[model samples]
Target: MKGNPSLAVFGDWDADGIISSSVIINAQRHGMIYPIRGQAIIEYEPAEPVYLSIRLDEIGCFDAIAILDVPVIDRLLESMRSYRARCPSSRIIYIDHHISTHEKIEDLYGVVEEPLVGYVPTSRIAFDRVVSLGYRPGDRLKLFVDAVDLMDRGAMVPENMKGLLKIVSSISKALSYKRDPALWRSAVDWISSPVPLSSPIAGASMEEIARLAAESEKRIRDEANILAISAQKLGVFRYIDARRRWMDRGASALASMLYRKLRAPVILCVASRDRRHVLMIIKYPGKAYRVVKMLMETGIAVSIGGHSSLGIARIPVERIYDALEMLRSSAIY
Candidate 1:
């Protein structure tokens, strides 16, 4: 089995995680033929211990496993050797940007991939990586992926109705119906819609986008208000006026900082759509750091305060339970 190839992929769960896995799988599906089988373990911070327990046992006889968007953490690479002892046929290939300390792990494949945004989620990375792998999707498909990536990354969307709907449907399906990779994307029509920036659902343009954002802001304040108040009150929220810019990332970055410093949920931070800045504080009080990881896996941004502790991320607004359920399902969050 050493010379023969049977490949698999594993990644950290985040928008990037989903997209990255999709890239590898899409590449294989489209004739890249590198990976024949795989499973992605989504988690906040890649929860090295949990991934090791589950994926280690699962890879008993595979020839290769591709690790993406996940952190191997200190000394975990040494343990890979332990796994290889039993399944000596296996080789590990890493395509990630978050590794430290190379001690203890012997001979493996490594490919560091960058995020469109500062450490963009895995899905966005996956979309571009798939293209780099030589599988150019149709314009519509590309637009759809781009739109979702933008939303997840808190960047701007192109003012195209078709792309917007495709993204909304795809994400909604993922959250509501468990649709994987939007197998039904082709059936959706891509049409251009004129949206004002100030509307509740603006995309690429500032006029309609502002309108959309205004509405979204109101909705969030009304429903997910507790989290929004954190940014509003503390005045720590950074808003990017540039379209396709990384607004969601700003929110995640804020969450990480608060978590590392406070280690509790007393800070209710509001991470809203880009095009404007928001600032506040509400009431989060538990392990605050875990929220970003959990939210990223689902391809959503986390609101500070109880929203993070509740395991709810800020996206779609209709699926608060979905995010909560995701966190509850995980042992760490």
Candidate 2:
């Protein structure tokens, strides 16, 4: 890196994203003696650019800009390219797993991307990539990672997870009770554990952490069909909430939440959210996938492409009700 950003980290709200952002932010928060010395004027930003600029202006000029778990929007990338053309001294570091591109996105001074699986719905590869960027992982970050994995990926508990002797043991519990459970409490605790959305150093303290995690869990359980997790935080981190059922991890969280609650039928995943009202979808497992293909065959005026299992297209919310009605008549809904 030519020079580290005065200081900033950006990622999605998922476990991978949140943790990734926190790992770096905490480095500053808890007072890590980073060999990479940042200018005291370098301020950290969260959520909004409007307020962030207030501080950035006070600092005068940012040395570098670091991007994490999330992605750089195409237009913003264009803007950066244009701005950089004017200011030759500025540099940027982008570490991300999103941004659907076959070749690595070029032009940025430094770029690192974790693979957003072409075959699997979850960005498992990307999550690991996020963790690798940290200069060193903290215990708090580790616990936060377990919390997200428990809710997002560690849905399966092993035989050893039955005893709630340890605090961070949800995956073990979930796996232990994948089918039936003598100790579902541990699994529930894991799901209920506060997956840190932001680090205590960044102002999301441990006390607040539990509450946020509980809120997120309740939201996912009650509403979303798919649930994605990340340890980073970013601007404009997108999650597809077409039916408000799809949570984050594609069809798995959807199916589990549905059946765990009432075995409700319709469960699927989409490629994009907040993207021009169109969607790319992946309906997993059973014949539900076939229903997706059937929808495209109806000659709906939209771009729909993917396998019977996975496809991409876009649809407006204005047509959402009509689409649902169509699915209702079909056997999938």
Candidate 3:
């Protein structure tokens, strides 16, 4: 596997995904400690299901593929299995922290699955796994990984980590569920650099994004406040905001703010940017498994995925009420 091995690394566009891919590629290039040796590393960061499907077609070209921090694995198992059967020498590695997909990952054949629990992000998982394989990262690298974990898990305030958390959050906001290779490369370089994180590195567009995120937060706060007082609770507190541009961006933050304040299972459906679709975000604290299982059983949500206490699903605009009824009947929320 050491001689000019072709490699493909796939991850989400979020902090965990980008950092995890960077760790693997950096290890592969140095070859001083990590067991992985690859001649060329190809990276794919898919922003949506359509893009992900397209990238899946390219998997057969690589000798090894690492899927990190990608939660929607049930849709890829068949393609992966076919690829493995076609290229018996190829290897696939999966690392994730989404608890709802544990069984699915366990079922995939001819791949290495490293599923973690609690607030651990795939970057930390990749770091530990690489170290176990004899890759010794420096103190700065470890600290950066730890900062990412804390930021992703919402475990720290803005004051902690010497302003690294703000930097990561600002960068992620600028990315906005989209893949920008150049911006991503800059972020990777910063994380892998030996210098300690001291100042914020906002991309050209990041200042604007920061302002927009602040505005969105205010709208979400007001909406969530209304829901906290008036949402209908049928197994879960359900609220739908069909206001125009309600989901222009940052739906997850809204859902999180609601959950943090309500301290109860919350289901939020926000109109999509096009107003022709709805995106659902559910947070159930210790009951994420039940909520995810219920949604799957309904067979309505497309590309559903969940971490330990939060889940997200996409639904057709017309089916929003039907989905709510299904959730109400499931009694699992």
Winning model by lDDT: 3
Question: What does candidate 2's lDDT look like per residue over 131-230, in tens digits?
Answer: 4555444444555455545544437644454232123222322322232221222222232233442322232233344444455456546554334331
lDDT of 1 by residue, 131-203 (tens): 6655664454455456556755455555665545444533332322222222212112111112221233222
* Regions of candidate 1 where Cα sits further than 4 Å from its true position: 1-5, 36-49, 75-79, 97-121, 124-133, 137-141, 161-333
lDDT of 3 by residue, 154-253 (tens): 5745455756566666666556533466666666655655555543343645466466446645666887787667656766565545344357356776
**Clashing residue pair totals per candidate (backbone < 3 A):** 48, 44, 0
Error of 2 at 87 (Å): 3.8
Task: Name the runs in model 2 displaced over 4 angstroms.
Answer: 1-5, 28-42, 45-61, 99-216, 223-333
TM-score of 3: 0.78
Candidate 3 Cα errors over 4 Å, as ranges:
1-3, 31-35, 38-50, 111-119, 152-162, 177-179, 195-236, 243-249, 260-264, 271-277, 316-319, 329-333
Top candidate on TM-score is 3
lDDT over C-alpha atoms for residue 80 of model 2: 52
